[model samples]
Target: METGKSYFFVGIGGSGMMPLAMILAGRGAMVAGSDRSLDAGRVPAKFEALEKRGIRLFPQDGSGISDAQQVVVASAAVEDSVPDMVRACEVGATRMSRPELLSRLFNDSVRRIGVAGTSGKSTVTGMIGWIFDRAGRDPTVMNGAVMTNFADSQAPFASALVGEGDAFISEVDESDGSIALYNPTIAVLNNVSHDHKSMEELRTLFGDFVGRADAAVINTGDPESAAIAAGLDREMVLTFAVDRDANLTARNLKPEPFAISFDLYIAGDFRQTVRLSVPGRHNVENALAALGAALASSIPPPRAVPALESFTGLRRRFERVGEANGVAVIDDFGHNPEKIAATINTLHEFPGRLLLLFQPHGYGPLKVMRRELVAIFAQKLKRGDMLVLPDPVYQGGTVTRDVTSADIVADLAPAGIDARHIPDRDAAAAHLVASAKPGDRIVVMGARDDTLSLLAKRMLDDLNR
Candidate 1:
């Protein structure tokens, strides 16, 4: 909580942990951390970049907890038996959850805009951050994914930006119930769907998140988000919709394989024609949410539209890896049912056969959403589309493997889908490469596992050969 104090993150390279650690280091704090990936000698480049920026990196051993004066920061994923946690206990260092520390820093800002949802939080957060930055607000922004707009030679993984301005923007997480921690001046709820929690629990958490904001941006297009907004005072809410009437609305929509164009209407008045470089109708909804949040913060619609138009996209969301011999490879982070459905729907707008390699992020998610995931894939993927599955990526946890990718593949086969369970990712890649045709589009989809991106590249190389 104080400057010049030493802080060590337990899982520093995690999507949520990395940006918060970077923000602390940028604020002149003594930042250092350890990660399991570094311990296993995987993804050394990300940690090496942190080290070059003056943040100390160590293996997940007990060595990072050098003194009692340091504050040990960790996420909910870190258990008590971990070496860093044990060492922190022995050394008497003050321990804090990553959310707690992030909320502390976020609350200190003059104005805060927090984006909360079941999906598209990272993209919407990046959009708002880019809009504010382009408008010369110089806002301090935090995101779970790398913003392509901010990626450069020095900070290739530019997930967080430290700027001198009144606004602090971040994507708040409800999966861990950390969305309740921060009180924001402007809060944007993109959509509420089942991810890590139940519908009742998600509704309660998101409702509280919206109720706490001075001005809330509600997505009326999503029934759950609309329900949450209905309970709150209508005067304090700014609504955005694609289907019905709202304070800000998107009309005359067109969806392409890699791009979309739409017209913007503010309060039933024609504002301007907006175009997005990103695909999917969901991204159109995300743009509306970002626009509403910007308007709620008193930025005019005209000023924000240009930034949204120029917004390229995030790193893994519908990112094109490469193309060779009429075969193209795309890397995406769509593990949950809603996310996967969105990506598949976007792909249907184009005319290419899909060869999908999906890795479930965890065993618990597979168990919880197995039926919904199967139903989604059955409905979205046509007969020509093929699905390949490997075992879920395990990052050292005791989990119940009650349901697996094999079960989903079995379910899909009965539904007329071309699904296969290979178990081994390497074998799956080889099979996909061998089966790929000239017009096939290879899509690598998953989350939490950073190696999936590398696998996407490998598939592209094999296709080229």
Candidate 2:
């Protein structure tokens, strides 16, 4: 962290890796990195953003690790199997995990706040960042998603902010065991669901995460999170909820397509009634989490309210990609049952023939949540709605052979929700556009793949054409 230290990242284009790279490069460090897949060339937007600030990109051929003193940073994904990793060991280079580097920087800061959750991590992270940003805390914030608040000619996504203030706030990941690395002043856990790893592992990781924090904010509605809140070191835990009693809660709940308005109640006394720009009960839950996190971090209720109001929602979270011929195209990252149900449930609020085009993230997740996916679509999808499935995304990694989106479709089609398996995404998009009526909504859903958003936009463009 001292001035001018050369840092080489193994998997630099990852959402987590990109923000850290930009932060370090912005700090006047010599940063360079590599990735295995560069097909879309979209990662260049990330590295080029860093390159604009003087960082360079190289192939993962060990050239970036040439300097023995270089700090080689990478994620758990970057194993000793990779050449850069082997080179780092060969050259006696100081190696670090992405989270470890982030923790080193976070711990060095005078103040730090971390947000951790399974579902609302990005949205909550964006909310906390906005609250502090508007309060003139000018805190350095690292987020997984594009925060539209700080978009300007210089930084569009605003994933990493260079704040003048001492507070260093970030959204830490418990799913990947990175949350264990962060020692934060405040930790926010929105809710823990099945995303990565098992509940036993997540419990240990998230429990340790909140234990290290000066204060831990949790969602009492989720049994897992509530248990974690109860288990954490006493007097440091702050709870937020919509139903069950907690330290800070959002009561008098309401939901709408345009926004969700609710009354905020902290401990016992009545707080301010606020309206979230985003829709859904899930977002209402997200607001409570953000509200609690910001309040525990000492952000004034007045300041946090306006920041939350001005928030424009995250990209691909029930995002309206485009509309053509009266049919709306929506793009969302809802590969899991909880996420998928949330999106479809929101769509049900508005009047339309819901046409869903879903591609599972991977074979492993498809197998893990196979029954849940079937139930989500079967339960939420109306008789007026129809679902189309494409094959799980494959990038030549080892995957379960038995798992496929088609299997889920077969399971759901029998339930009579108008389910069909269309393996090719392009064909599925075309089919959706062709079959969609004047009042139909085409929702493109999946995660771990950026092409879902692009495909959603393309589907709209094709429909309009």
Candidate 3:
């Protein structure tokens, strides 16, 4: 949180690390770091944007860490055998995990809003940030994905906003049990599902998270979240839902291809009819979560609702790249079952045949949720819908690859789904592009890898030809 200190990030280009580095640099700290992606010549535009903001980028070699005074920030994925960690240890530099530093900055704020859940965290975080910005709160925001509203040519990766206000908004992570680190003035729990952790472990983590906050914005529509909300004090909890009853509810649901609209109700009275540029009934749930957060932060319904109308959404959360030759290509961060279901269901609302190319984020997650993943695909994918899977993303780490994308495809075969496992991502993309036809939607889905966006663009280009 020190403004004048020097900090070096080990994986600066990562979704979580990039934004923290940007926040530190924006606050007048000397920020420098290295990423394996940068060294491997991937996502050059992201690193270039960092350099433009006066952040120095270095290769992942040990050369980046020299001064003992520099604080080295690394994610959990970065092993001790990595060159950066080795150099930091040899130089006696201060070391901190990415979540440790982020939690420090978050806990220091006078008014903090922590968005947490298995899915919709990034979208809800972006929505709350945009609401605050539009309401003239000038809140500082940190997110895991690029908020398209804040993105432009100069700041293409606008995941973090450095503000002079006391309000700090961030999406806290629960995958690594780091959700406990955040202490929020207003906590938003969107939903709880199976992803990266067991149901029991997730309940405890999310319970403790909302329990620490002075006020909580919870999704009562989700059974797990509703159960947690049941235990909390009624006066401190603001609940939202799409179905059934809650403090804040959405009615008259109407979903479109790229957008959705619904009526917002507060405590049994209709407040306003809300429309989001982002698609899905799930996003309507996310909007209610953001409205609950804004309400907790003392922002009026009029101000928050108008801001959400203009909310453009995050980069990879069902982002439509472009349509070419009558085929539409979408890039999505749908690695988990819950998120993937949202994307697939949203698209199914329309009449297009889905050509899905899902790249598993990592082998570890594939191993954990293989059954759920296969079940969701089997249940959701229609008869004509085609699915192709590439090998799980492995970034040279020591991991147990007991399960792979091939396993998911094999499981789907029993359900009569047309699924294929293509090991190479390029080959998968080629297959998807070749299979795409008029009125077909080619969706490139995954997380943890930045190159997926580029692949989506390449598919659009090929379709155009």
Candidate 4:
């Protein structure tokens, strides 16, 4: 957490790690790191972007850990066999997990708003950060996705904003059990479902997360979160919901093809009619969570609700790639069952056949949620819609291969869902383009792989051809 100290991140180019590295570098810290993707030239532009910010780059080989004085930071994914980790051990360097580093920095802030949930963490964090920034709070913000509102010529990857304000806003992780590390002035739990852990484990983690906060903003729509809210002191908890009665709620919900409008209400009194450019009912829930947190920070609903009107949304969350030949394509970062369900449900709100090209983010995640995912897609996808998949992304990690994308397809087949496995995204894209008809909405969904966005654009070009 020292401003002027040197730190080395093992996987620096990752969405979570990159933002923290940039934040430190902006704070006058000597920041440097290495990534397998950067070393393999998978995403050279990301590395170049980091270098432009004065961050030193190194190969994954032990080259970066030259001195013991440099604290080596690594994500939980970085195994012991990784060269940088071995080098840290060899040099007796102070090694810190990515969460620990983030927790230290986050806890040091005068005011902190921790956004925690299974899904919508990144988007809600971005929304809250944007509101605070637009309200002239000048808050330092960290997010897993790039905030389009903060994007500019110099900072294309505007994931982290270094501000001079007292408030520090960040999306905390409950998947890796890192949410317990943060003690926030306001904690926001959007929803909790099966993602990286079991329901029991999630309840324990999220329960502790909210319990430690000075005040908590709970989502009543999510049963698990609502159960947690039941135990909290009424004075210490603020509630938001679209389903049931709550302190704050959204009523008369309207979902359009590319946007949704809802009447914001607090304690059954209508506050304002809020319109979000972003698509999906899930985003409506996210906005409510963001507004609750904003109110927790003393920003009123009138000012907070207006800021959501201009929220352009984060990258890959139902982002429109382009339309060609009257067929529209969207790029989304939905891998888990909840996220995938949300995306599919959102698309259903409009009248169009869907060609869902889903690339599983990781083999491990697929193995964990395979049955639930199969059930979700089977239940949500209409008869006219089709589901396609490449293989689960293998980024040179050791994982169980028993559960493949083909397994999910097999499970969906019995449920009358037309699902296919192509094993390669390029092939999947070609098949999708060939099968897509006018007015079909082709949604490319996944996470972990940065190339998904590029693939989405490629699909648009292919359709145009």
lDDT of each: 0.91, 0.81, 0.94, 0.91
Alpha-carbon shift of residue 322 in model 4 (angstroms)? 0.8
In candidate 1, how many Å is residue 414 off?
1.9
Q: Flag regions of model 1 displaced more than 4 Å.
A: none
Q: How far is candidate 2 from the true structure (C-alpha RMSD, Å)?
A: 2.3
TM for every model, in the order presented, reads 0.98, 0.92, 0.99, 0.98
Please give the distance, in angstroms, between residue 40's alpha carbon in candidate 3 and its true position after superposition: 0.5
**Which residue pairs show collisions in model 2?**
none
Name model 2 segments beyond 4 Å from true: 37-47, 232-234
Instruction: Report the CA-based lDDT of candidate 1 relative to the real structure.
Output: 0.91
Better of 1 and 2 by TM-score: 1
Per-residue lDDT of model 1, residues 233-346, tens digit only: 999999999967999888988987789999888889987888899998999999999998888888887799999999999988999999988898999999999999999999
After superposition on all C-alphas, the RMSD of every candidate to the true structure, in Å, is: 1.1, 2.3, 0.8, 1.1
**Model 3 ranges with Cα > 4 A deviation:** none
For model 4 the local lDDT of residue 429 reads 88
Give candidate 4's root-mean-square deviation (CA, Å).
Answer: 1.1
Ranking the candidates on lDDT from highest down gives: 3, 1, 4, 2
Candidate with more favorable, higher lDDT: 2 or 4: 4
- Report how far off residue 358 is in candidate 2 (Å): 2.2
Which structure among the candidates has the greatest TM-score?
3
